[model samples]
Target: MTDQPTPRAQRFAGRRVIVTGAAGGLGQVVAELFRAEGAAVVATDVAPAEDVVACDLSDDAAREGFVADALAELGGLDVLCNVAGIQQFAAIGAITADALRRHFDVNALAPLMLAQACAEALVESKGNVVSVASISSVMGQPYNAPYCASKAALLLGMRALGVELATRGVRVNCVSPGGIATPMVEAAAAGLPADTNWDLIARSTSVIPGFMPPADVAEALLYLASDAAASVTGANLVVDRGVVW
Candidate 1:
């Protein structure tokens, strides 16, 4: 048989991209995929690698610092993928102000701030921003109030930015993947309390069984950032197999 076709190979040729949280999980997959599609990618994460620039997204000064480094490396930006976030499991009774602050700091605030910092360059290129939200953002998960709340904030904030940046031709959107097979999910699941109720947590699970592969979610990000989604802004593309659609 003839070689199978790649789905839009080199779709991002000549594009410059920046992916946060690029050291692990879905972020790693996203960065690699974009580069395969011919985009020049600059990657960063709190966990540094030889190729990944390290920046603690939770720090105020660090956000801008990372943005500057990313922009400088790319010379300009054509797309920004906000894949960094904090996902944790905590019981309501055990949750504290510090927990909420920590969740909001990374999951919600950092993405929004990064988008704002990159807005003008994106406007210049008519680029798009895609962030990784969560299925929990659309529906609450048991004992995950902080994680759910923070992701919900991210979803709405991106939608609002989509509207504000529309006049400037910069699209903004999110991908709320369902349970993904990633270290973040594994850690969160492992941290669940002994009294955790599976039935309750199952209520918000995907119609399609099992956790998705991170590469699958990366496809969603690529679609939203591609010209294929030129008219798709202010939207949350749920990749959880109809969990939130």
Candidate 2:
């Protein structure tokens, strides 16, 4: 008898996926994980990678073009991971209109637009979406008014989308992370006070021994995008090492 072909890993094995902000940090890791797990990952960012498409998230034309090209290049899309975001340290009194708009454009509005464009394809594939919110959605943090507010809005948006798309078999979920060690964090750390108590903050937020690496956040996203999470939807998986609880 002829040998049979190997069984596929899951629905992801042949599916096309779109990951925004895919050039760096958590976005890069998340895109890589999906690719490793057998998805045809269309990694996208304003600054493209050799294997990714570069498109500006804030530009309406660029966002539309990305959706169109993603469909054309990948044949169709199965998952959308909205991992592009920006953060600013501004107290409520110090929050400028430009600063807040920039944060919202990247952190909240971009994801919503991407989702709107991909919803029809996702419904066709019965695929899911995973967004990257932050722990600040649930807890208060000083000197980050706009970032926190934008993340909170992202969480709510995920919930609403999950409900609206339920009957169509499209699931929407998000992951909230605390104190992830990315280049952005390194830059912020360089500006900290001489006596900043880093350990205290880590211990307070993370139930895990070390501060979370980007991979930790990426894996959480992979789970939400996988068939293992088939019954899961409208959930915000908080990977803060137990910070909010």
Candidate 3:
């Protein structure tokens, strides 16, 4: 039998990466994966850790502070992965203005604020950004108006920023992943009313039977952060198993 080929070394040997919401779930996976790939990873969440900083993304000042702290801790930053978000479900008739704004603050505004704050350093290093969008961004989700709208805004924001930053050598892109096994997913599932028909929603989405793990989405983020994607930018990679394609 022929021997198997040896795998190549990591692509982020000297890079420094920042991952938001890193205490658990997708953010945690992204941070761990980057560390595995040889990058100096700085993970942040709403709570503090030995290496992680407390970052309340809904607060604008906290967002700025977190961006600064990441650079200060890492010495420099090469990749900014915006994966912090919240999910709330409410019917259109029942959606409150506060709820909608809260979603935007956590999901859309936080990423934009971080990107803007890190622009100078990212441009200096010719770094890249990877945002965690959602399949809901492309397809309207029933009873999840705020979440869907926030994600949609995030997608467009990344696309527009990619175009603006391309000339400066800082690449920007987003990944819209389907239902992944995360705390957010569980929250969404639990938020459904007793009479809500999840099967109907799932059928409408038509996603594959299995749940996509956080690592599955993080791999795509790693790829975008690597030099292999040197020419890729302003792109929205849909990793939803053909959902929203």
Report, for every candidate in turn, its global Cα lDDT versus the true structure.
0.90, 0.84, 0.86
- In what order do the candidates fall by TM-score, top score first? 1, 3, 2
Better of 2 and 3 by lDDT: 3
Per-residue lDDT of 118-236 in model 2, one digit per residue for the tens?
99999998998999998988776766678888999989988999999999999999999888878766665443444545564443456665668899899889889888999999999
For each of the candidates, the C-alpha root-mean-square deviation to the true structure, in angstroms, is 2.0, 4.7, 3.1
Q: How do the candidates rank by lDDT, highest first?
A: 1, 3, 2
Two-way TM-score contest, 2 vs 3, winner: 3
lDDT of 1 by residue, 48-101 (tens): 886798999889898898888788888899999999988778778888899899
- The number of residue pairs in model 1 that clash at the backbone is 0
| Model 1, CA-based lDDT | 0.90
Q: Name the better of 1 and 3 by TM-score.
A: 1
Supply the TM-score for candidate 2. 0.88
Best by TM-score: 1
Which is the winner by TM-score between candidate 1 and candidate 2?
Answer: 1
Tell how far residue 53 is off in model 3, in angstroms. Answer: 1.5
lDDT score for candidate 3 against the true structure? 0.86
Between candidates 1 and 2, name the one with more favorable lDDT: 1
